[model samples]
Target: MIEKRAAQRHRVFKGGTITFENGGIACIVRNVSEGGAAIDLDAPVTLPQSFTLAIARDNLVRNCRPVWRSDRRVGLAFVQ
Candidate 1:
């Protein structure tokens, strides 16, 4: 396999939330970079194309869009 990421991802294990109009879902950030993040969810749920990723402990919130998904994990790209 070849590396295709624009930026290098750093491993992380932080609790966070995925927020949208209706409500929010709890998740764990597995990895992160300036451009995107990998989040681990509790279950397989329908997520919007765009949403907010709030990492309160880090005092950070990023607007994001889903780039990929698996059973309980999602890859997100930060939206400008």
Candidate 2:
């Protein structure tokens, strides 16, 4: 089982993208919290234990790490 640290979750439906410097892909934010988010990717990528999320237009970028993942979904937790 996975442990959750969020007190509340906020749903996100905006289009987004993910990149690993060498390549980039499109994805969608399933939901978000102050500290983390879940994403739906069109194709799966081998995620690092920790990475960064660039939120377009908001000028907000975050460093996050994978907490759990499946074939299409991944849960990310912010790195404090």
Candidate 3:
């Protein structure tokens, strides 16, 4: 089996919104960093190729893409 390199990670938790082309949704952030973030979403939600994250704290809004996903979680990579 091929091994995937683990990315540099930082643990963070916050509330954010995920807006798809079809509609908008909400999720809880499991972890985050300048480059990417992991979010725990309820059910299997279809994610946009790209989406915006509205971080509740500083109101830092950033755009990211879905890099990986599971039944209840997704990994997003911040777009440069």
State the lDDT of candidate 3 residue by residue for 1-76, as single tens digits.
7645356676777788887667878889988777888999877877768988777785878789998988899988
Residues 4-80 of candidate 2 have per-residue lDDT tens digits of 56457778786666666567667788888888888998877787666677778557577888889989999888777
Candidate 3, which segments miss by more than 4 Å at Cα? 1-7
Span of ten consecutive residues with least summed lDDT in model 2: 1-10
Each candidate's clash count: 0, 0, 0
Give the winner by lDDT. Answer: 1
- The model with the greater TM-score, 1 or 3, is 1
Model 1 residue runs over 4 Å out of place are none
Quote each prediction's TM-score.
0.96, 0.79, 0.81
Cα lDDT for residue 68, candidate 1: 95
Per-residue error at 28 for model 2, in Å? Answer: 0.5
Clashing pairs in 1: none
> Which candidate would rank higher by TM-score, 1 or 2?
1
Local error of candidate 1 at residue 78 (angstroms): 0.2
- Show the lowest summed lDDT stretch of 10 residues, model 3: 1-10
